[model samples]
Target: MGTSNKPPKLLRMEDYPSWADKFETYVQALNYETWTAVEEEYIIPNNENGSNYRLSQIVEGDKDQFLREKKMLNLFQQAIKVENFQLLQHNGSCYSIWQALLNKDRGNPDMRKSKMSLLKKEFDIFTQVKGETFAQLVERYCHLVNEMKRLGIDKPDYEYIDKLANARPEEWGTFIMFQQSNPVAYARLNLARFIEKLEAHELELRKNHNMKSTAVP
Candidate 1:
């Protein structure tokens, strides 16, 4: 998409890696000088009080460099969709904007190595979010697993099931305990089958809850 007139739109935060790479290539190809500007400076602070334009006017006297920086900043603005841009609070400059988005989606360089640990923590703490639908929970669960895979933490299907069981909500306690006691049966389960079983158990829990709620006092 960056090959076309328009640069690739990073529709989802997860797509940043490829999108950033393509956008970088596009910027370099479009104008090497603009790419040079990006490496030259980080974003200037913006505030109604006062903005430190042109690297706090460090490049202010250098008219040519200042112009290149502005042009690169404009390109960053245009690259992101208007609505998406509005949704974010990106600082000006190619370096700052890129760094901001990168940190937002994927943590900074220092945090990169520990990303697997962070994902594991996320998986460990993950549970049905308040007011989240079963389908939505499943979607989030799947995404987390994919993230773990991206970080090179591939596990057997049954291992995934074990983790999922531990992450389930309180309503799933009985079903989880049953599975826990029957290791062989649970070990045979894959992601889909495990989720299917959870869904069925959820319905039973719901039915019982409804029955008790409607019971005569």
Candidate 2:
């Protein structure tokens, strides 16, 4: 029997469409930390439809940033392309399968398993927050504030700081603002830790709800 030739690989990054190549180049220049921060701030929420209310602002912000630094825009585009490619590779090329998995009722066990595996892999790549409870987060925030005060610095306002350090994942914007203010050298550092804790809480909520449903049988 004649051997079947494998399909050629997808176009190289340089051979991609002009826009895509530009974006890819921009993304390649960013350090992993900055790239991850940008992805978490923009791309993830957009994928989940969490940016519906802020779509205009998000687009405008992107345009302004891109205009100011074409490289940054290119990186943003590249990161999104990479994410899409990963999803497609995982789920196969069947749009029907994708739709079924996206639809709550029609989703199959296999699809769910695949998706859970993907989520686990992605979550593992991030730094998990140390504390799991709300109180623990609050305590960390207080400690951070006190440390700043001890150094004879005008610390971030306690009220605003508490609001963010203890916020739910849905309140991600609040935490981003806190990171920007940088009341302490560890502001973003602590915020990343707190976000990891929130991810654990969200998973627990899903698991408990699923258990409650199964128990009804």
Candidate 3:
């Protein structure tokens, strides 16, 4: 058997397309503490006068600091951009480097507010695009809701259900019609049941359309 030469898939920050796209993946990779252990364990010691030396100026004699610096050097080499690499190079210690990276990548309060506003605006006018399946549309709608909640903009479950139902494409008209005929029951139904009922009706409508088309020819 021939050996494959493909690199192993390690979780690297640079793999994601953008900062927003990277947020969830990065959080999962580093967990809740976000590499704090690395920062604490790899401390840079002070000089004879008790003032710490800059990481870039650290000497070769201190094997531990040298190795720590080398690890940081490797991190910068694998960094997404030259600017990021340069920024990381200036850190006095691992903690400072970690803090800098976190601050640069994490969204602040104002940024979160702006993002929440935009997501809410889009959700308010949400619509299933043409040719989009019921499952796909529901998935998108649920994703938007999840993102909003993550940003601390929690909304009621009923509100989400209403918005999702209203935004559905015309192909889901049969489902809407059924809901209209039994408004009380529909209003009382849970999201899972709602999704199943809507998708079932959508499938029935497609089946009927196909049957009619075949009969016509």
Candidate 4:
């Protein structure tokens, strides 16, 4: 293999259609199984029998495939720039890491600034959609935050929390008011704690609505 033990190369940004294409080309030249690790997302061959398959009983083919995937991941990680590494920090598999990079701005490095600008605009106007549960809203908010962080745009959590607070629906008015009244407590609330409280309140609101609907008229 021409790329023998050579980490996947991060070529000139202009060479590929997207930021991830350079790595894709490198991986394609690595080897059959390693390339498949990213393309087909090769998985360990499973046992045909219904019986439990022990770790010690893993076949040679499956073991070789697993090792190849590990090598691919290690090479990709070691070759990527530190600033760009965040894109794959949460990803485990070769396919996942590759997908994360491809999802970033187009091959043009200049487009990154524009992409960040678009993300900021979206964050400024972000709000929970109607019929979206509090948990779902939090999940969406976190995903946006992660995307921004991956691009090196770090916004204060507290500031974003305030943005989230203001986006609550009319039914959340009382809960919002409660948080507003206790400024100190609200200031102390991080995203996780805020989500916990919101989930509990959501449950209570649903329970009350159900009881009211079932009451004798």
User: Which lDDT tens digits does candidate 1 get at residues 40-97?
Assistant: 6744445566866544545445666766778787777767776556555555666666
Tens-place lDDT per residue, model 2, 93-166, is 12332232234321357765665555444323422155555556455544444433332334334433345543
Per-residue lDDT tens digits for candidate 4, residues 22-42, read 455666666666777776575
Q: What is the TM-score of each candidate against the true structure?
A: 0.47, 0.22, 0.52, 0.52
Candidate with better TM-score, 1 vs 2: 1
Candidate 4 — which residues are off by over 4 angstroms? 1-107
In candidate 4, where is summed lDDT lowest over 10 consecutive residues?
A: 10-19
Model 2 ranges off by over 4 Å: 1-161, 165-189
The global C-alpha lDDT for each of the candidates, from Candidate 1 onward, is 0.74, 0.41, 0.61, 0.70
Better of 1 and 3 by lDDT: 1
Q: What ranking emerges by lDDT with the best candidate at the front?
A: 1, 4, 3, 2
Pairs clashing within candidate 3: none
Prediction 4 TM-score vs. true: 0.52
TM-score of candidate 2 on Cα atoms, chains taken together: 0.22
Candidate 3 C-alpha lDDT tens digits along 172-192: 676677786886886787777
Would you list the clashing residue pairs of candidate 4?
Answer: none
Error of 1 at 183 (Å): 2.6
